[model samples]
Target chain A: MPGTRGRRADARRNATAILDAAVECLSRDPDASVADIAQAAGVGRVTLYGHFASREELLDAVFARAMREADAALDSLDLEGDPRQAMVLLIRSSWRIVDRSRALLVAAERGLPHGRIRELHQRPLHRIERLIERGREQGEFRTDMPVAWLSAAFYGVLHTTADEITAGRLDEADAPGALTGILLAAFTPPGQPVPTAD
Target chain B: MPGTRGRRADARRNATAILDAAVECLSRDPDASVADIAQAAGVGRVTLYGHFASREELLDAVFARAMREADAALDSLDLEGDPRQAMVLLIRSSWRIVDRSRALLVAAERGLPHGRIRELHQRPLHRIERLIERGREQGEFRTDMPVAWLSAAFYGVLHTTADEITAGRLDEADAPGALTGILLAAFTPPGQPVPTAD
Candidate 1:
C-alpha cells in the first residue's frame, strides 16, 4: 500500500510538472516541440507521452490548466466594495491571467476543439456580466447599454489592448493603468459624475 | 478642342459614377460582379470594362475612392473647439465613413497594394494625432501614455466598436454614444474632473 500510494503521488507530481512546462514552452513558442517541452519539464519524453497520449490531449490539459489559474485569480479578488473599484480589480487580475494565457491560446486553438475553447472563454465573460449586473443595481456602472452589450464592449477593449501591445503601440507596463482608466470611466452611468475628482 | 474637352469630362464623370457604384455594391456584397456595378452606376459593362481593365484595377479604384470620401468627411469636421469635444466630433464622423468603408476594406485588402492601403490609413491617424496633441497641451487628455499610443488606443476602440456591432453585440444606434463615453472618459487627463456632470 505504501509503495502504491507513493507511485500515485509521483505520477501526480510528474503530470503537474509536464502541464506547467507545456504552458511555459508552448506559450513562448506555439510551435514548440514535444521534446522541448519534455526537457523543459525535466521529465523524459516517454513519461510525458505516457500521461498525454498525444499533443492534442496535452493542449487540452494546458488549456484547462490556464483557464483554471485565470479563474482562480479572478475568484480571489474582493468584488465587495465600490463596484467600479471592484471591477477594476477584477479586470486587472483578468488582464494579467489572460495575457499569459493568450500565447498558449494560439497553440491550443489549433489543437483543441472549438466548442471547448469557446465554453472556457465564456466563463470569464459571465464573471464580468455578473459584476456589471451588480454594478448597475448598485448605481455604479452605466445601465443605458444592456448589461450584455457593456460586458461585450468591455471584453472587446480588453482583448484589443493585447492586440495593440502586440503591435508595439502600447507599452506592457502601462497596460493595467490604461485599461483601468479607460474602463472605469466608461462604466460610469451616463450623465453620472465620475467618482472622486482630485 | 471643345468637343475633345467635353468627351474627357464625360469620361471622368463615368469613372466617378462607376467608383461610387462599386463602393455601394461591394460594401453591401464583396462578391458583387462587374456587371452589377456597371448597372448600379447607370452605365454598361462595355463602358465599365473600358474604364477598368480588370476586377483588380476596379478594386483599386474603389479603394482609392473610398479613402478619398472618408478623408473628405473627416476634413469637414469643425475641430476648432474643446479638444475633447473636437475629438468626439472627429471620431463620430470618422466612424460613419469607416463603417461604410469597412466592407470595402475587405475586398481592397486582397487586390490593392498593402503599402497603398497603409498610406491611406495613416491620413486619418494623422488627423487624430493632431487632436491628441491639442488635448494633451490643453490639459484635457492624459500625458502618461505617449501621443501615438493614445491615438492608437482610441483608434483601436473605435474599430472595436464597429466589430461589436457587426457581431450583433452592440446596437448601431448606441455605438456612437458608447464609444464616445468610453473614449471620452479614457481621454481625460488623470485626476481631472470629467466635463459636465449631471
Candidate 2:
C-alpha cells in the first residue's frame, strides 16, 4: 500500500512539472511542440501525453492555471466598499497579477479559440460589470454610458497600460496610478473633479 | 524607344501588384511565404524574386506601404485648430484608416523589429505628441501629466477601441465617439466639461 501511494505521489509531481514546463515553453513560443515541452519539463513525450491528451489540452490547462491565478488575485480585493475606491484598488491589484502573467496571457490570446477566450474572461468581466453597476448606483460614475461599455473600457485600459509598461514606454510604477486616473476620468461625470489618488 | 517605355510601365504595374499582394497576404497570415504572395499577385516565383530579393524585403515594402497610407490619413487631419476639436477630428479620421489597415498593423507588429516598428510609428506619434502639447498650452488639457504620456495614452486608447470594435464586443458606430470621449476626459483638466462632438 505504501509503495502504491509513493508511485501516485510521483505521478502527481510529474504532472505538475510537465504543466509548468508547458506554460513556460508556450509562453515563449505559442507554437512550441509537445516534444519541446517534454524536453523543457525533463520528461519524455510519452509521459507528457500520458497526462494531457494533446497540445490543445496542455494549452487549455495553461489557460486554466492563468485564470485561476488571476481569479485568486481578484478575489482578494474588497469590491463592495466605496465603489470608486474599490475600483482603484482593483485596478492596482489586478495589474500586478497581469504583469506577472504577461507572457502566458499573450500566448493564451493567440492560442485560445475566440469563444474560449471569452469564456476565460467571463469571471473578471462580471466582476468589473458589478463594480460599474455599484458605482452607477452610488452616482460615483456616469449613468449615461452603458455600464457594460464602461466595464469594457476598464479592461481595455488595463491591457493598454500593461502593453505600455512591457514596451518600456511607460514606467511600471506609473501604470497603476496612471490607469486609475484614466479610468476615473472616463467614468466620472464631466465637470466633476476626479479625486486624486496619492 | 516606345517599346522600352511600355516595358517600364509594365514593370511599375508588376511592382504595385506585388506590393499590394504582400500587404493582403501578410495581413491574412503574418507568416505567409513569398510564394503565397506571388501566387496571390498572379506572378510567378521568379517574377517575385526579380522584384524583391527576399521575403524580408517584401515585408519591408509592405510595412512601408502601410506607414505611407497611415501618414497620408493623418496628414489630412487639421491638427492645429481648437486642440480638443482637432483631436476629435483626428480620432475619427485615424480610426477610419486604422480600421482599413488593421490586418497590416497586426502583421507588422509581429513581423518587424522593434526599432523598425518604432520608425514606422514615428510620424503618427509625433503628430499626436504635438496635439497633446498644443492642448496643454491652450489650457484645454491637464499639465500635470507629461505630453509624451498623453500621446501614448491617445495611441493606446485608439488601438483598444479598434480591437474591441473588430472583435464585435463594441459597436462600430459608438467607437469613434466613445474613443473621443474617453481620450478627451483623460486629457482635460479636472472640473472642466468635456466638449461633446455631436
- The per-model lDDT (C-alpha) reads 0.74, 0.75
The TM-score of predicted model 1 comes to 0.65
Cα distance off (Å), candidate 2, residue A29: 9.0
Q: DockQ of candidate 2?
A: 0.28
Q: B1-198, model 1: which lDDT tens digit per residue?
A: 559889999999999999989989988887788999999999999999999999878998788767777888888888988997797788788777767666675566445553455456677878888998888898887766556655666666665566556556667887777667667776776556554321
Docking class of 1: incorrect
Model 2: per-residue Cα lDDT at residue B188: 75
Give the fraction of native contacts in model 1.
0.35
- Candidate 2 chain B has its poorest 10 consecutive residues by lDDT at B109-118
After superposition, candidate 2 runs with Cα above 4 Å error:
A1-12, A22-40, A49-60, A105-119, B1-12, B22-37, B49-60, B103-119, B194-197
lDDT of 2 at A93: 83
